[model samples]
Target: MRPISLLLILIGCLWSGGCQQTRLSFTQVETPKVPSFTAPTNAPTLAKKEFTPLAPPEVISLSDELSLHLLPGTPSKLVGIHLLAVSPDAPYENLDILHTALTQLSVKLANQRDLPCIEGLTIHPSIHGLRLSLKCPASALAQAVDILAQSWSSDAYGELELSRLKRQLALDKHIRAFNGSEIEEVWADKILGSAHPYNKALNNRELQQSLDKPQLLALLAQTKAQSQWHLLLEGVPQVDDSLREQLTASLSQLGAQQRQEERFVDTFSPYGKQLFVIDAPGTVQTQVRIGYHLPMGLADQEDSAFACEALSRWLGRSFSGRLYFDLREQRGLTYGIYGRCFNNPMARILKYYGATQQQHTGAFIRGILDHLKLAAEAPPSEAELAALKTSQFSQIALRQDDPGHRIEDYSQAIARQAGSDAMAARLKRWQTLTPEELQALAQAHFGQEPVIVIRGDLARIRPDLEEKLPEWQLKVTSVD
Candidate 1:
């Protein structure tokens, strides 16, 4: 299959469905020569390096607007390129132009890098600018970066690249229609309210109308002039002096495009007092998505986020989370219940999603809210708190071993509204929280505003939902 085709399929599987359970195969294992098992050891004398937010050995400034963060020693020969473009401006208007320019840049970069993976360049565009990435051999690192520095370092967009982006966009639209829905939007709209600054969904018609050469060129210029840039290197800590010179030379003479001249924060808040129902008539089981803008505490204060994260993991992230124990392990309402928190400078929201029969939708949602309410009201029992901390600490240790995971974890903090210090603040922040403080923190944010969204057969589920929350207004929309 073509790389793009394979990538889309992989993404579809990851986003729309649950992971397949691992079935162990004893048949693949050979009997030991002694037919004996070694006893497990928790050696007191063994010293292990615990994980901390990785700090670069040095941050090399390439230009006033750019710097290279070197995460030195690595066992692999690949150079990881994490180019984060943070836009101080919000409500980044005309995302389509920004996206198209990026697609062109990726094509050019991949051609130069000879990306071994099926998916070469990854672009994650948010309300801000974007996080663009590529990984290549350490030997060709300079060449790869030269391609990048040369591409957007000036107003060099051409008619050919624009045509290529147009074709790909149309092709992508058609391909996606044959696939499943990108349901993150559904959850975001229901939880954060569509008016949230970060919730801006790019409109295709608007993009197509604005695809003139002058507009595309202007977009590229603005990106160069206004957007802020940073470099994060993993697998190799210190870069060669030659590479540093190249980066500095390029940065010093790069493009003049500037960021969008606006900043915004979404003031829209959802009242947990309301219940919303949208009818997707033909589906047998209802799909549920409940969310609220996560507490601002998650973004600004280390102590607040640490507490909220502990609560989040115990409540939804792990198999042992409360939602799994209550909704799946006990009532058998659905095969799974998933909850998570997403944060940016402009907004942060806690969202939970699950599916069940129409008759069971009301009870499940009510149960979830009650669970959230309780989680906020009091600290987890000693056992629950220990489990949450263990899971979190273990995951942190494991992440250090996986370069990809480390890159992604590091990425989240850099692109957020918070400056680069976000991750640094999170380190050991959990260790500082008292049990009482943790619960108090969760309570402070959880009690704010909550929005309940149910996509089900309203004719069958509405009455039950109504019975559960009597006075709440339920907004219904047509799925078709």
Candidate 2:
């Protein structure tokens, strides 16, 4: 409710007795009503997009070094250009240079374009391959493709800004210290893991020893032109005749395709029960990592990947999981802990990592190992299996509503020469897993004794650790 105010004024009469006779002047002001807002429903599930996968494009044979897979779709104005390059990890000269070049190229492409900027242009160079992914506006797709072709064809482009790359060639000491500080990363990368060609400390030695411009250039050319590469284009915009001709000419220069298989498995064997104690001075809290390598990985038996992940969740992630209860709820040793099966192209590794004080380290290790040995022999409880399935279903439901999810799956499938739907179908299999099957999976993969790594102030806890596990063989190393 609003109060109405009125005023009487005399225009041509004196203010004495004319007040009542004066004309009354007033205005009615209407108050505006506020709009009521109805909140959107917090629905449990999103309506999943109908399954519409890209029809397979004719595989273009470029050469022994290159192959192309094209996927056409109705969505307009956006395109993805993916590049996968495979090479032996030898010729460590340009390892850092590859990282430098891609970062430089990503920046160059993003800025020097009128087309929707190249977004998420990432380059991950590894021992096996370099995975490159970029999304651009459909309007500039052809231009982006031309630029990629030029990156190979031009002798000057990758090396255009040599001075800039030199600055980033060395490892940031701060980053190195930080990673070393995270004791988990150091153990996997430094102590237990295979020697990386691009190891930062090693980079300083290799970069200086092999700093030949001509040699580096030759290596880059050989990498881009001769070595095998896979190309996957998803959500490619419809091309007019002019654009089609441009693309054909641009990609054809790479010369026919040859398919290759990854038969090389990492010859890795843990040096049994060796406890590597890295000395991080002034550190009161210790980071402990324990696990062992599996002989075979997901690639060897793709069907078991889901089961591996589900088991990982049951042991580590869920509130009711073993690691959570043992490390956090019961012992109050650490805030969080993780145990998971890791898959590289060459191997699968079961790893557990967590943080704890010097006093609790002994208890944490014993508790984790007991669980590991127990899980290997026995079946998980019905409650645990239910928790694992609940997580799996939640992930499946989310993926269903995600068209991008399917697109990514299709692209990866094409790269591995696999059926796109194979990954999704495994969820159904996860539901039907019997206790025997789960136990077998655990025993088969994790039956071996693990390599334990501890990084902390060794001076503080060495006596306690030795006293706790007297029979254990412990090898101590400095974090140099």
Q: Highest TM-score: which candidate?
A: 1
lDDT tens digits, residues 297-387, model 2? Answer: 4455565555456567667764556787766776676788787766443444567778887777666676677677777778876665755
Q: After superposition, how far is residue 213 of candidate 1 from its true place, in Å?
A: 2.9
lDDT of 1: 0.63
Name the lDDT value of residue 3 in candidate 1: 98
lDDT per prediction? 0.63, 0.60
Q: Lowest-lDDT window of 10 residues in candidate 2? A: 26-35
Per-prediction TM-score: 0.78, 0.73
Write down the worst ten-residue block by lDDT for model 1: 26-35
Shift in Å, residue 4, candidate 1: 54
Deviating ranges (above 4 Å) for candidate 1: 1-53, 91-97, 104-119, 153-156, 159-164, 167-183, 240-242, 256-265, 295-300, 417-424, 478-480
Per-residue lDDT for 1-480 in model 1, tens only? 699998998888788765543332111111111111132487454444555655633667776678687764446566777676666555455676567677776666556545463146677666655666667777666655555565664444653466666776776666644332434445566666667655554544556544777767666666666667777766665667877887766555554345455655456655656666666655677777776665453344555445546666767864778887777776766788887766555665667788887667767777777787777766766666655666677787788667767766656555554556665566556556566866786687677656776676677666677776676788764322
